[model samples]
Target: MTSSAVDPVRLAGERRRIFLALFSALAIALHALEFLLPSPVPWFRLGFANIFALLALFLYDGRAAWSVNMVRIVVASLFLGTFFSPRFFLSLSGGILATLAMTTSRKLGCEKIGPVGVSVLGACGHSVGQLLCAWWLIVRHDGVWFLLPPLLLIALVTGIINGFVADALLQRLRRHPPFEDIADGAHSDV
Candidate 1:
């Protein structure tokens, strides 16, 4: 009953919000950087923003991750002048769905599989989201299905890279006890 007795629910909510804000800002910055850099491949990106999504999975839960992702996409798009485009919506859909899949899979006791496994799952979900959008909104052609193989391949590669980055960041975050203490205080499900 004492204040020292941490309220797990309150802590969890606070941690979730903090993580969400941090990830959203990170996502926006990454998105802006990608635009400023202007890569050769139009849609291809390092997916630096996804690091936060993966972190959310490990630190919080699926719902928290998804929420953070959605906010990031919307805010990033608005800032990058893509907020109203079909591409923006498509990418958002794909990214959110993918993050959700990865977080959910991890939560289901697949932790042993690690970030690589989660990334692969997320990549698949990303591809699915894109394909759906292409079919329903843009091309409206069955040939779009043919694009899946290559897209999936790209997703796999990028996902792995993103996963590794996330893993590294998580490791670094873990080493900092002050951050961990803040995180625990915010998300203690005790």
Candidate 2:
């Protein structure tokens, strides 16, 4: 194929891969950074890394979001020496559910929901996922239920913060031709 004749289909796929990889690294970095900060609530993280997954989901799709999330969890866990541990599983479950919630909300709400709504839902999902896992694996007691109220409230606050960040980034990134070019067929099967 001529240089100008380069297949858009292949090009789009390549661009997506590149973005996914970049998102994963960014997520990992943020995850590590959050780990260093002292938690206001015990065992609670600000979840700064999820912005990239949200970005990937909006710019691409759920699969891309999942890829970024999974990579972030696995790589960050390994880096933090938590790989193959309960903490890793907790992180894994939370990331999985968060991405799912975001993707589902986006699909169901369509034009009605913006980044904030999607992100809030995702954050709530992540908290619920981790809470359930803790109840099942660690706490195994009814008393663990008390954590829900606080966790959900935290999730709401954190989600709104993350959502606003994602919203600002999305607005700016969408205006970018290179990003927009690859994202042109974002809704299409690539």
Each model's number of backbone clashes? 2, 0
Candidate with best TM-score: 2
lDDT of 1 by residue, 49-148 (tens): 7778877766666676777678878888888888979879788778867886787678674536577778778877888887888789988989989878
| Residue-level lDDT for 157 in candidate 2 | 92
Question: What lDDT does candidate 1 reach at residue 45?
Answer: 63
- Model 2, position 59: C-alpha lDDT score: 86
Q: Report the number of backbone clashes for model 2.
A: 0
Would you give me the overall lDDT of model 1? 0.74
Model 1 TM-score? 0.83
Q: Can you give the lDDT of residue 95 in candidate 1?
A: 84
RMSD of each: 3.8, 2.2
lDDT of each: 0.74, 0.86
